[model samples]
Target: MRLAEIPLCVWRTRGQTFLFRGQNIRYWTAGQGEPLLLIHGFPTASWDWHYLWQPLAQRYCLIACDMLGFGDSAKPVKHHYSIVEQADLQQALLAHLQVRQPVHVLAHDYGDSVAQELLARHHEARAAIASCVFLNGGLFPERHRPVLIQKLLLSPLGWLVGRSFTRDDLVKHITQIYGPQTRPSESVLDDCWSLIDANHGTRIIHKLVGYLPERIAQRGRWVGAMQHGDVSLRFINGAFDPVSGHHMLERYLELIPNPDTVSLHGIGHYPHTEAPGQVLRHYLAFRQQLQPFKKIACS
Candidate 1:
């Protein structure tokens, strides 16, 4: 599909603010029930949620929005585009939606980092959250990113590369996302490249990458706290993922309440895209088996 052909409908419109580093914040809503928010990772947008949308939309109020520099959202030069900002913005978004009840968050890649900040705020504010369903990413900064690219992102050239990135750079970079054993099809690669070819294009990647400092600094705080049995977390992984890797979940298991993982064999970095049906099935199954807890409020 052409970049212009991408389908996006405004789920809900907000007054607009730069609360998250001066981003054009628009929280989209699609379908209904339980208010499940779906957050996507880097190099991709809400388009990542395409497959899981139809199936999961049946049971929950599906929510997915582009970060400041992604999808149909604004890609501003002045925005900080950091997780610190995104986390705060997300909380504000829920407040704007009047979502006082705990909501389920399905986050990936960069979204995972943002999710941590939101979770931390939840714990601090005594907010209600049913549970977090992990997918292909996590809070352990050391375990989350690959070294070489991490260096590039942290390097001086990051800004230049980010602002001047090309479609070829994305295709080349995404190649490493897959495991050594598995390869994504040309079409899959095309879809990813085409999406990035939209608004933010290459410039926002540097801004997105710049958030690594934010991730590393706040990495252990929330997940570490959760590791102490304060919160519930689970993992569902793409076995062939080269970026987040398979071993990171092991690092994750060392934390969390009763962390468990399911590896989708033959899948790559973007498992949701590589295997959507399987991803949805694993997610739904995990949702069903959340060890039902009582929701009665204490006076």
Candidate 2:
């Protein structure tokens, strides 16, 4: 299966439909039991969880979504997919999905950042997030991407990424993303390009790159989530991640309290997809470890 299932983005949810703040975004979900919401990062959508759905589905109600702009969700030009806005959208989406209890988030890349925003709003989220598995998108921007592309997208240089989508650039980046476990296939590159191309994917290059707005907005919330003791956090660090280098895990620990950090030897950024079997085995074992939170004395 693909890292994430892309076709879901194209299909709208049947029962759940609500306006988030204002933007109408669509998410795909399946299964039953406690709600498990999976959010994908940039350049990819809910497809990231394609391989994870089955194993996870057996345990909890699984809901994976294409965040507003990136996935096949509604893509309105100028829509600020910023953190605050996405937080509002996420609440509305959950409400529409009839999600009442706290949800466990399997977040990566921008998705993890979104989870950070959610934790800030609903303090209960800290306790309810059965676990958040990080796959190297650099949630802690200090050690993550932080600047560069964000500056470009926000500034004049933005036009460069916005207007350009060369076959080589797409291949190089996609290929590089899977350097550790296995090489990214051409189909994956095609799907990514399709997502970018599905809608003037190239034009939004700058706008999508501009996702820093969401990260910047969540900076404070990340700190808040760290201080708050409700959430259970763990890191599946990709040993070979260059961009994140050695900083992501440390920063993750800073905010996540006594986080359980695991090392995926020789893996790059996309651990879930790169070493699905390996990740799955470890994740299952991690889930079995028992831990209780006193902070979340049930109301």
Candidate 3:
């Protein structure tokens, strides 16, 4: 179902607003017990977790927010959409919610890099991330393959392209990332386009795409998180994703020590959206394996 069709009552009851860095950050939380933070990837927001919300909330306190430049959050015309900054915003949100316990992180695409940063912070005793589950993300910069559109978005000439980017272009790039079998519906594309244009975000596509280089520059820190962090971690991949699909998985196994992976053969970049059941089953199993000794206290 499209985000717009999620029923007004659902949004009214679960939707929330928080203040972060002088911006109105939109967030949502539900269920209770251990805390679980959900982070979205590039070009999307918290709505990315709509499929896992209820099932996950039934077990843990699910916290998700639109990062500075996407979703319902304020999109500043000249802001640094750095992954470090995104990670900071998430920490701030947890603080604002009075969540003091360690949280399990579920991140996708661009969110994967943010999650790695958070994990690095936890390693240095700056934050608390009990575990992490990475889905179709560029965890290994050298192993990633950016599509032609992403390359242009990262180039100096991106400003010219961003200014002319249209709904059709958005759908094209987005649909291309998904496997052919699970292409997004027209309605879903419409909703995503609306979210992208929520605050003239389309005009700042170049700025938002800045995360690509930041990923490469901060490669040591992020990759180190997966390689050495004491926390439990797993990579759930959609093999069909051309961007960071099976190729990334190959690199992950090579670099990471005793890594864990769940590959969905036919799924694409958006396994959670395309194969929610499989994603949920794998996630539930991962959580169960890392089941905390006791409930995390949030006061």
Per-prediction RMSD in angstroms? Answer: 6.3, 5.4, 5.2
Rank by lDDT (best first) = 3, 1, 2
Per-structure clash totals for the candidates:
3, 12, 0
After the best TM-score superposition of candidate 3, give how far the Cα of residue 182 lies from its true spot, in angstroms. 0.9
lDDT of 3 at 141: 90
lDDT of 2 by residue, 1-299 (tens): 23444243333343244455565565666788878787787767777666776778788788866666765666677654465566566666777877778777777777777777777666743334545655677676667653344455678767676677565676765565454547667776666666656556566656666556556656776767756765666566766666663467667655665666766667776777777766666666556773522221110
Writing each residue's lDDT as its tens digit, candidate 3 over 1-299 gives: 22213532355357788889899898999899999999998888778788778878889999999899897789988777788999999999999999999999999999999999999999899999889999999999998888787889888899888778888998878888887788888877877777778888877878988888899999998888778848888888999999998899888878887777788888889988888778888888888886322221110
Candidate 3 stretches with Cα past 4 Å from truth are 1-13, 291-299
Model 2 misplaced regions, further than 4 Å: 1-24, 124-131, 146-151, 213-217, 254-256, 290-299
Q: What is the C-alpha lDDT of each candidate?
A: 0.66, 0.64, 0.84
Better by TM-score, candidate 2 or 1: 1
lDDT, model 2: 0.64
Evaluated against the true structure, the overall lDDT of model 3 is 0.84
* Tens digits of per-residue lDDT for model 1, 108-211: 88888877776777777645666776678746777766636546756788777676666676667777777555566676566666666667556666667766
Residue 262 lDDT in candidate 1: 69
